[model samples]
Target: MKVKSAATQVHREQPLVLGYKVDIARQESVKAMYDSLVEVFNARLDSLINNTAQMEPYKPFLESDPDTYWRTWEVNIQGLFNMARTFFPMLSEQSLQVVYGEQGLWASCVNPGAIKIKITAGALEAVRNVLPDRLAIAGDTIAWLASDRKEWLGGRYISCPWDMEELVAKKDEIAKEDALKLRLVV
Candidate 1:
């Protein structure tokens, strides 16, 4: 009920936005979401942002509950896989650059830095005594990335806190070295 209410408020403010509640961990639910999106948008989406995440309170691996720890994996990894697999065909090729070695589609991962949020007294309370980053930092960076000029950044990991202009300045160097990717150091 709260989710629906929030969705209604968002739709009122931004009519272009559409919202649907789905269990992203379930492939069937994700497929249903894809079907609904395809019906509404005629099977072409400009951007897809997978922001669903589950973070358990900081704890040692041996001390953490097995179910809770794996729930994070289900929500984070499995959910991402389901969403990407279902929505890949619907993504617009013209707007975003090529990604996943595909000629027509583009995909990039973004790490939106931790922004200031109200943290009640809890396990995470000690971790952030004072949150320094503003919400606009991540929001604006993501908006810029979704714009037409960010095609070159496809398949790269983008950190929202980085200065976009300076990052753009180093694009050549980044591409040459294939930086910002997960690499195992021997």
Candidate 2:
């Protein structure tokens, strides 16, 4: 899909919709999809925006459906792992790998984030009108990250709504400390 500000709508690029959901013919389908993608862009990627996700119903662990929970884990977490494992090496030097799961993160604790909205009017929709990360913000941030200067931001879980000025101020420290990257802290 063409994601951009209204002014930039004139530009359009092919979107690759490859996914593992259709397991009946997933391997063959994925191979065809990737083959075309590799051919179109010569197997070179400037940036890979992985927004693939699934969310389980809000419930206690014991009450939650095992199938539903695992599906969420498989798609949101494992999906990223698989995509990265296969596609990351295609990243050109100074390219980006972004997992935008927590986009508009300030809007909620976050999963299947605030990006999509169910429109209702004159109702009890306590719509989050604050800290709302506009679609443009996410688009702009992704573009910024796709640039060479933001290379250090790679291999991380990036928040689309992170305070830009604060991040800019701490950019040096972030790079130096290798902060904001995905890591498991003991």
Candidate 3:
């Protein structure tokens, strides 16, 4: 749906996109796409963002399908890893964008009180969260993050709702401490 959504956006002239579209979940398709990108437009790739994820089969553990879990892992974990590995060599230090969306938004949405309506039962119910980040917050944050102003945040996990100004103020701590970057620690 990401490619389709990108196509729709381009058609609507809503979100300006200046690159070719490819689904990362498909290894061949993405490989071909990036291969072409390297051959044809290698010089134009200033940034590469990996927002790939598949949180499907969002049902309770008992009801969850194993296929869904596999697909989700394929796209969310393996695909993301592959894209990053494949594109790492193509990146230029002058200016490159690397964003990893933490799925914190949707995770939050399953929780009660985060939104007006929320999932109240089953696998998704247990996945309840405080509240996911807003769509605009993520979108706007990404836009701002892509700009030169936030270039220092080159390799970090960017949560959508975190205040940019607040982050900027804490840039020193972030860069030095790796404050907002994703980690396994609780």
Candidate 4:
């Protein structure tokens, strides 16, 4: 009886490569996000021009803690920006724009009466702008070409109000934009 080593057995079992066309779509997506961030950050810094004070704190942290900041930004805002930037164009081209609303709007209207009315109104306005009529009109043209359906995605944009209320309460204590930039980099 011959003993086949694990490595040799695994190698023999593995499938042979054929006409391989490795799709690097995900890698491209990640690279696009990185490039956009670099562009936006550079533009933002350039607009400040000679403001050394603005970049002072972030400079040290940027060199030391890029990965942490990248992860934090990726989850908080960059991810959203990247997804919208990439998918929105494709969706627009394909004529599939789905609009969703936050349930908080209705909750605010029902509870606390007038106190929450303004917030709810603002939220509604934001929602409206996100799914503007003009975009919808263009979507119709793309829909015709792609044979896609035009519809509202419809979901609760707002989750819990408690977190927002807490943020509002502590707004004064929150760090300034420059401090935040430094913290984010670190």
Best by lDDT: 1
What are the RMSD figures for all models against the true structure? Answer: 4.8, 7.6, 8.0, 22.3
lDDT, candidate 4, 19-118, per-residue tens = 2221222346544554564455442211100100011113354365666555545544554444444433333333333332321111010011122222
Q: Estimate each model's TM-score.
A: 0.80, 0.61, 0.63, 0.23
Model 4 quality (TM-score): 0.23
Which lDDT value does model 4 have at 186? 38
Candidate 4: where is the Cα deviation over 4 Å? 1-27, 30-70, 97-186
Q: Return whichever of 2 and 3 wins on TM-score.
A: 3
Better of 1 and 4 by lDDT: 1
Ten-residue region with minimum lDDT total, candidate 1: 114-123
What's model 2's overall lDDT? 0.52
Please write out the lDDT profile of model 3 over residues 81-137, one tens digit for every residue.
778767755654323454334311111111112221322222355455544444556
Full-model lDDT for every candidate? 0.75, 0.52, 0.57, 0.32
Q: Give me the runs in candidate 2 sitting further than 4 Å from their true place.
A: 1-29, 92-132, 155-157
Most accurate candidate by TM-score:
1
- Model 2, residue 17: C-alpha shift (Å): 11
| Greater-lDDT candidate between 2 and 3 | 3
